[model samples]
Target chain A: MGAIQGFEIRRSSASLRGSATQLRTLPVVAKYIDTSTCIGCKACEVACQEWNDLPVSQTEQVGTYQTMPSLQASYWNLIQFREVDYQGGVAWLMRKDQCMHCADPGCLAACPAPGAIVQYQNGIVDVDPEKCIGCGLCEPGCPFDVPRYSERTNKMAKCTLCVDRVEVGLEPACVKACPTGCLQFGDKDTLLAYGKHRVTALKEGGFAEAAVYDPPGVGGTSVITVLRHGDHPEWYGLPKDPTVPVAVSLWKRILHPLGFIAMGAALFGTLGHFMTVGPKKPKDTSTTSGGEV
Target chain B: MSDASVPASAHPAAPGPSIMRLAVHREDVAVGDEIVRHRLLSRVIHWVVALFFMVALLTGMPIYSPVFGWMATLFGGLSVCRWLHAWSGIAFSVASAVMVLHWLSDMKLVPHDLKFNLVQYMQFSAAEDPEIGKYNPGQKLFFWTIPLVTLMVLLSGIPLWWPTKFGSTLRQVCIIVHDVGFIMWFVAIVGHVYLGTAAEPGTFRSMTRGTVTKAWARLHHPKWFRDVTGDRKE
Candidate 1:
């Protein structure tokens, strides 16, 4: 019933090239996740559900402390728990799972519906429920496997980076509910620097593999994570190096334009043939007349 | 084969089971000098294939690119087009399969047809061969291409319909395959339509009216005209 105010779009799905103009020039924002200080608390998950007005999904324990194996359509934010063999003993490694809001989002590239997926100038990616046709192209488009298709609504759902809250000068609900200062939100550059700083402190304290996980493969993610076992990202259920699928890139960038050209050529070719050659008719018309049975 | 002396009402309706067949299946054999090129069943099958193909194309173009997004409104919306495209594609595939089987015997490429130069034919540089039978090499090529492209689209579309069941790698491959199949099908259909209608004046009547004039048969298919009409004159 209300118009969406604020947030200038930088990129939009299935739009013409150079159409999404960023007129407002908003500062790029990001969520900084320091996995070292996380206590495996599910506050962020609860906050995300409450803020988004999503119904709770019944999750069963599968011989682990995790609430679920992965994030669901209704459950956007998740705290992934992994008991890893760390420093000669087992330690609980916690990582917040959600959409990374990539600088070069694959979901936006693969989406065929106009205005379904959009990226704001503030570096927040949001899905317009009204515009989404639920073709499920975004599922294979995502490098992180983030987008979830809801059978009830026939639409794809994922973390929107709290675009509504960020527009109103408020941090995301997950960051607000995080008791441990592990979750923080601020300017993208500041968080990148702070995440790197934590990596240095963790390395000095004895973890040699402590590094910032801001992969440049997807033009670096909006959510920057500082992991002690950054060298082995798989331990925390994260891809070490993630990029948009080659098929999505090839289809959107090359095949789409080529298909139009090919169709045009076929049409024009037929017209040209018709004009030059004309219709094939009988040389003599006297014997052409006949009665059908 | 009735002559002008026989009254139209004196003849019984063409042999078929249904009432609609009475309209399609005309009086026994060609009257006067008209040659029966296609029967009522073949014409109906051909139209069914065309109907589903157009439905699939109209519904699919919108999803293929945003440039044709306005076409989605004809069916309902993009969401409706999504499922409609798949269902129509299935219908198209089924109709195409029937068409393929119905025309397979006539569409076989003989060794002599190998010399049928496509470029020369399109440019009107070469004349239609007198030895050509029911179908020319070009027509046979288009006929065979239908089933091949239809199979490609159908196989790829199955995975796309249930995308969550397959891996990302497979779905990505299917996307490219589906688009490639679409382009091939579109281009072929364009040429087929042109040749069937405008390019050849009397050809369209064969599919619609189930007959062509003796002169039309002689001009396009000389050998077939001789076989049907017993006219051996040059």
Candidate 2:
């Protein structure tokens, strides 16, 4: 009986081994933004909706021209209208909100579903509708909360950085729709240089806090920002100093696989040991009974 | 019952029996001589996790940027790598979820597991720690975190893929959550891989072969060894 069981265990283990030897590679693309020339028209928002064919949101007068309340499953991009006190006059802060398409995107790392969320060769975050189960796990992992889950479709949706357009060598709809040359798309190097020059020109024109917004945090965003004020990134609804959660790192690096291995070994070991060894031999009792005659 | 009446030493001293019957260690629990452990299904499920996880990590790096874009060369080119990375990520998540369901019963934190502060297991002195069992407290902690991290990655990745559809505020939030979660996951998986493949010498074999030597069981799991071997005395 023990031999048969042992052979069976070995046979099963051999058959179960799988080849998980595939290596992954990524693309080289840049997501650039030129905030110097933004007119705060929110044309990018309109363009994004029209091009993507998204439903229009019934936004009320929220005291600001910034209409859409927040990032939702349907609205991918929004131009935030902030009324900032600059020196003496109230300067209208019109910042376009969308995926920064970080050089090191957190969404890609956090996503478990392959193709559900991906980065293109041009460095844009893209999603696969078919693979998404709308588990809503990636929502909390994002430092920027870029991905939104649609209850209707039961899948998360967000910006694709116009990967389709970029693939065909065309500018994104939002960039093209901008009447004021505010949103610019190009290679990362050129965009960085342009952003720096723009910042210099803005600061020279007496906009003191006109600094670039792409800190080394979040592995540096492809979409660079030149804010009108510098009080806080959070004041503009951005995290002050974003860092990946410790729990995620712990799980990715150690807990998940190790746990699986340990559990597998333990379960198998216990079962195997039990089946082969059977029950412990009954304690010796003949001597105590004095059965010898 | 009749066999129980015989003196243990006398039975082994029978003249016909060899003085030293080389003890055959059963692969499963030995009933005289027997062994059993993981069947094929369990081991296959385990390796599925190991394989997809690596693929997910490799493909994911290039998507993160040029710094790791060189990684793309491994998969063919940047374009192919793009779709591959996302798909592999999904595969890893699904496989891991299956693993979670398979091991949920055993991984539940029992009272005995709670007695030992898990932090202590990370220390160098843990090798000698008596409380350590077939699965240490640290291992249990790592097991539980897998589902949590997988869930985070999946949810945050959605808006990133189709940002135009999600609201602006939510997109912003997803960015933050996704980045933060990735860093944490990167660090944790590194440590986990180290422990499973390198930290323990005999462990990888258990996952691969689905069998451990009797000696290994005795050294690592004394109570289990005793119960299996039915040895009550020295």
Candidate 3:
């Protein structure tokens, strides 16, 4: 369940050198969600909470069918219910919201704590609570806005893609509990082929903009969805094109190495100056006691 | 005067006057041929700033990069360092603020200071301009850089401490600000320490014992040497 040796870690957040050597022996896994078929019944959400043993959070009457506005620290999964004007009438767009677990995970890239966030060979991104220092870098690092900071534990929490279950050859709890055949899990390549076929079927069935939601900016995600209106992903509470934030990218890529160089230069510059120029001393004191005032 | 091993209490005039001296009065004074560059109060504030700055640096470096992760062990762990860095950072900021306010008048750049070239100063070929005051222009520049960098770190750090209070965009900006500010501050401190100790022979005692020899004062700060000693002879 924890730090399974069977799965090779592809990346470890803030690792000094690099993460464990990726064998790439495991097939990349993914979840296929046909959002067009979802009936807005949040069985997946309940299954996630139950399997993970997350504490129940209080929900207020927000005058909407949605249980809550967004995912919380304890509530790792959510079913976003967005009402949009479609086909000249109001239509409900229900999306099962959770971590995308990107191929190039921003949360992992932005994290400064060693082993706080990790991506396994099977493409599962997980946060280790014990290692998380809760600096909240992951909050801004995520392009999909998945990670939630737990004030109680002083750490960041997010959907682990159910690594505990996946390790035992079991499908994620949410995927297993889905009743409408809307959610399916398997190898990433196989799921993408299935999702694309569904998208083609939707396009032929009068939805012209139907497309597979596998954003290439993030190198694609483990959770690929077939959206009826993929042209307007914002309608489904997803970014049209999501990439790691430029600030985070620059900070991790450029600044980290530059900082070391800058500090080294300061040390060497001072040392070089001292070695050549020597210490400044009074000229007339050479003949005297050298200590004479 | 060269004996750094001499304790602060050994200075006959060091203990009494500064105890009752008001904060408004300048601490720079002379006793016989020895000049008091920093008073007891000034020395205390200076050390407090140094101590807290070191604490902040040690705690923050671990969080900045995993290469220094071992540093977290010195202060319990990474989680402990998270809060310790913030609190120590605040202490360093406040101490720096007090330092800036206390030395503002002395640090103001005059027309002569405008000609102070850093490249020329590093050569160490000639004596100080004789017109130079309590601190050289280079030292004053470093003094002013302290609060500028501290304010950047402090302002950016507040948003980081309570991430939920601020937006993601602001938080990202603060991350950059905090890291860049830290690098600049660290480099400046490195140069400061060098200049305060090894770069100048007698400079360390000014902070340690709050005094410098008349020769040290005359060589480093000639104009202030005249002001303190009333010695018109160059």
Candidate 4:
């Protein structure tokens, strides 16, 4: 029994070490939107607005059945329509538009307000209302043009991928509302595998650009898309290359800390001298010591 | 002009008004007015900046997430939050711009200040350099960055507000530019808050009271103290 116990202790120590090393190699979750299977159903769009309680958008007929024209403050999600010629056959391409919830979200990176926008542990992008400061810095950073500024509230608004619901083991409102079995959410690895499988299946069915739209750039989007035609990603209004600007990184990594340190030092040093020295004394007082003159 | 006419004690007497020797320092100099705390105008501007910042934040939260969708109730609803966020952003940018203009004169980077890099200043162990002055290099840098970052935010926000009005490529470029600018601005402001409040003891008073003690002035800005007091002490 003693010998067996000693062997077990040795084995457990080895396993603990291995576990520690494994902990350091946490996998980065890649979120994506699969466009290949997405039908032109407006379920995702309706679900987004309804759950968020966003006001109905006032849109006009602009030669297409697409409502609300484009994404707006009240319209967090929109089903985009693009008529493209695929092998001489006109196909109406559909995509649900919202914040990409990117791994390297430009919106989170650009927001001037601390905690105004943040990326959650599960790779969902969220906004902190208390810290937003209505600077609208996140609006342009998104390649998808996800954020919309509200004039009335003087703040920026966008889809948060139902971060609250996702955290508590619930599907996003839009994902749940998707009746066509088009929108699916799962573990990133599983999703990637499933997306790949779908893409292979679509390619066999004669869709050429039936590949994945999750690029390594922009640190890879959390929302991945498996599109029917690769060429049509742009047509659906997705950027080929999304990246955090070098200027921003330089400012954050170098300039900001430097400014804080320098300023802090100057403030402290100057104040410290004044408190200690009091006022300047006469040169003759050097010999006075602690005694009164 | 006529040093010979003055008594020998006058030289030593000039450095009086020391808090340590109350009668000595207080005899000649009045130590200026009971340090004028932030005047009405300064207070107004400061509070306005703060108020607009809060307004912007509340309105912006719902747009970022449905979790904060509860924040939408503050502004009637999420639709209201959306519109409020954009307009409030404009308000913030404008307020920041006005602040820059208000403090422009004080914030100038003089030639003497060029030697005062933030890195060297942060080395707390070093003897306080006499070259330090009112509003050190770091404060100046912060003041300058506010306007530049505000400009970046405004420029990037415009295209996003109306994407179709701008070409798709231009909009993409704007998004990148805007996002990068916000990140940089956010980090800087964090440091600014720390320094303005908890980092330094008497620093917050400069913004609030609008006046600093003679000792504080002399210690932090020896040159300014000397200039104000006309005392020359090695």
Candidate 5:
């Protein structure tokens, strides 16, 4: 639901650095969703589809009103319905789920295709299908499991935060359709301030664990979810402290350069040896190849 | 010419036709007394292994990192590289397996190999001890290490090629192992190429032409040379 006026992509997948153009500065935009006030209406989901002009996906009931099992290639925004045991009875916890668009996006880091993933100066992360090779690297790269691969296109699909509408000085479709006023879109700083105020208000209203769930393990995210139980993100099926996978970090930061160094040293050392020592000569020159044997 | 009727030392014309004799397999009538160091089948299998190894290396490097992404262009793109790398790795493993069995009979390390000093060899100070066989300790060590390393590469590569079949944690570990195995193979192959070609003269031709000069065999593998030619006088 972020408004991304006057923004250019600031950070992007490093593989696409050769083609991507960088901007000097831009205001960051963000989406703030108050989960405590969410009604699980599926309005945002419909709005996302309508605005994006996506096709109706065939779905079957899986023992719950929850639309599809989880996020699908056709559905970017979803309302996760979970029945939790309250003080005495069961209570429904509905959280609107979408891409987090992290400051340090693991998908961007792990992507091998150039320009396949990009982050805007306003903090909207987008995937360029033209550059995508359908390698599915972004699937495992994401800690949140937000990106889904479409078999039809053989490319990754995820939430773009209504980047098109936000680019034209309008709020995202989901924010406009939220009847409960739970979804808010604005400059990142203003939204953070408003989110903080809302969390305090909820805490005062007898919600003990009411807090802003902007996880810092991934350097925070553009989408901030205000949760009633922020301490236990796992209850919402979110990683408690989601960070980039260990192998991805080691592969990109450590092994990438280390491999080059090792190969270079070996090649150069061998070359030096060949130049210095020359070739070993056969000691006995008297006999021919087919000797007494 | 290496006339089988006369001593090579007495034939001054040996040099003139020794080059032509390379066209035939002279296991008995050495090219001016040059020995058939490697047989035709042995040379063919060695090159087959080398070809597969190089193919695997070039194709696998790009998939490992975007830094080497240009290599993908050679095979069309990363998608093609992914499949090509898998097939090449399979071929390389199979060829290496064949090479292991083919060379196993001669590659065995003897008690003399325990005394082989790499430091002395590197400094060009080691004498040609008659105990050395068709292969030195360094070559034998590489021969033994490669099959193990190649198997590791193949096993680790399997998970990466079909990641979803395995757990995420195991897939992550496999990626690291595959990358490490790739680097290890790179180092080993570079050294092998250098030793076979530039470092040791007349060594590469044995694998290509399937023969080496008697003088080369005598200097490099004196014991093998003595066994073949019955020339113990080093």
Candidate 6:
């Protein structure tokens, strides 16, 4: 882990949920991967595990060249391979799949444990294994399905967007390991500008669907992917307009506070009855028949 | 007609409880002014269900979200909470089923309950009706709905307990249902507890001692008092 320099935490799951008094001093950082230039090399995936000292998981072949099919406990980054019909011929659409690090992270909002999932000032979502209880609530909380539960330690694990190296003024191990100049790391605004330039170049090269895939539904993400067919994110195993589930929002925003209030109302009602009506005393009619007065 | 024909002032000592009712708790013998209410078996089952509900609630809270992580410490930790909560939930479901079966006969709402104005009853302005029996419509409603809600919670919980067995979409739906069910259950139980204890004094003793005062029965349920005492008119 790199030394965190004046980087304040932005949001934490299950905090007292008050406005943060402390503010961030560091620049908002981002990671941009051009899926159009990716060559399906597994170097980034290898770099991620080696840099983090994460375990190597043995995954079964699931009829796909995309290694392991999906993210796993030990594997934070994966290259997803999909065969798409392009230019009247089949083309292999390879993508680097990892956490999106959403500004409004569903995992953070859906988390029940304090400090389990958190976003730092530099725009990286990370999970604290000690705080993670392995409930897997964050599993469905994620629209991309990134977090994986470790059976060994009973906690959730996910990509930190290489927070360690980036904090120390170094690019993420994946960006450093890319064979082509397909991966870039720097200020988010600069990357977005560069991404637009690349998208224009791609469109001129006869890729009509070339566009940026930084979805704004979840308030955008730190990690942006440049898809050749961005209009159809489903082809890349991505939701078209991904947002946090309504139930998660409703539960946290509405039900959580309302439930406590309702319970309080119940208690107050009972006490009011006691104070107003008191206990109903049973009548005493020793010699009387069953007929009451 | 035998006791009916007797003069109003000439009533003999109340007949002893029926010997056919062999269950000790079912013996409705009026020892002076007190009469048996719930049987011992019924009370035991009710508490067992309550115990398991609390256990499941506390353990499930940790797994539901990290906000309730402190609760995990009450048990061992989240590891122990996981299996403990699941087993307790299953136990609660089974116990609720048993309770529903045991009390089904008493919970059957007859035509008289339709005329039993619940609004007036809640307002504490209801006219006394001799047709009212052991359990009122309100109590019957609680008995019926609790089992249904418990079943709903169990059904929604299956996918969450085993994620790989189901798809991601189904798991998302289950999470919503499970959470909504919990909120509803929490509200219902709070009202039920208040009604059975502080709101209605002497009600708790029925489940604890399996009996109530003759005065309490006569005041709350005159028809039931007459039925047990057999003070019929000729």
Give the DockQ (2 decimals) of all models: 0.71, 0.03, 0.71, 0.09, 0.45, 0.44
lDDT of 3 by residue, B1-234 (tens): 111222335555754454224112335566545667787778888999999999999999999988898999999999989999999999999998998887788888888999888898888887689898888899989988998899999999999999778899999999999999999988999989998889888789888777777788898899888777667798
**What lDDT is obtained when candidate 1 is compared to the true structure?**
0.83
Model 3 error, position A128 (Å): 0.8
Q: What is the DockQ of candidate 6?
A: 0.44
What level of docking quality does candidate 5 show? acceptable
TM-score, chain B, model 1, is 0.87
Model 2 TM-score (2 dp): 0.51
Chain A TM-score across all models, in listed order? 0.93, 0.79, 0.94, 0.75, 0.90, 0.91
Q: Is model 1 an incorrect, acceptable, medium or high docking prediction?
A: medium
Q: After the best TM-score superposition of candidate 3, give how far the Cα of residue A91 lies from its true spot, in angstroms.
A: 3.1
lDDT of 6 by residue, A59-124 (tens): 768777777878988899999988989679987888889999998899888776677787887788
Top-TM-score candidate index: 3
TM-score of each: 0.91, 0.51, 0.93, 0.51, 0.86, 0.88
Ordered list by TM-score, greatest first = 3, 1, 6, 5, 4, 2
Could you give the CAPRI-style class of model 4?
incorrect
Q: What docking grade applies to model 2? A: incorrect
User: Which stretches in model 1 have alpha-carbon errors above 4 Å?
Assistant: A1-3, A17-21, A85-88, A286-293, B1-23, B26-30
Off by over 4 Å in 4: A1-32, A84-91, A112-114, A261-293, B1-234
**lDDT for position A142 in model 3:** 91
lDDT of 2 at B92: 84
Stretches of candidate 3 off by over 4 Å are: A16-24, A286-293, B1-26
lDDT of 4 by residue, A129-233 (tens): 655655455654666667776766666777777766665667788889887677777677888888889888998998866877876767677677888877657
- lDDT of candidate 5 at residue B71, scale 0 to 100: 86
Better of 4 and 5 by TM-score: 5
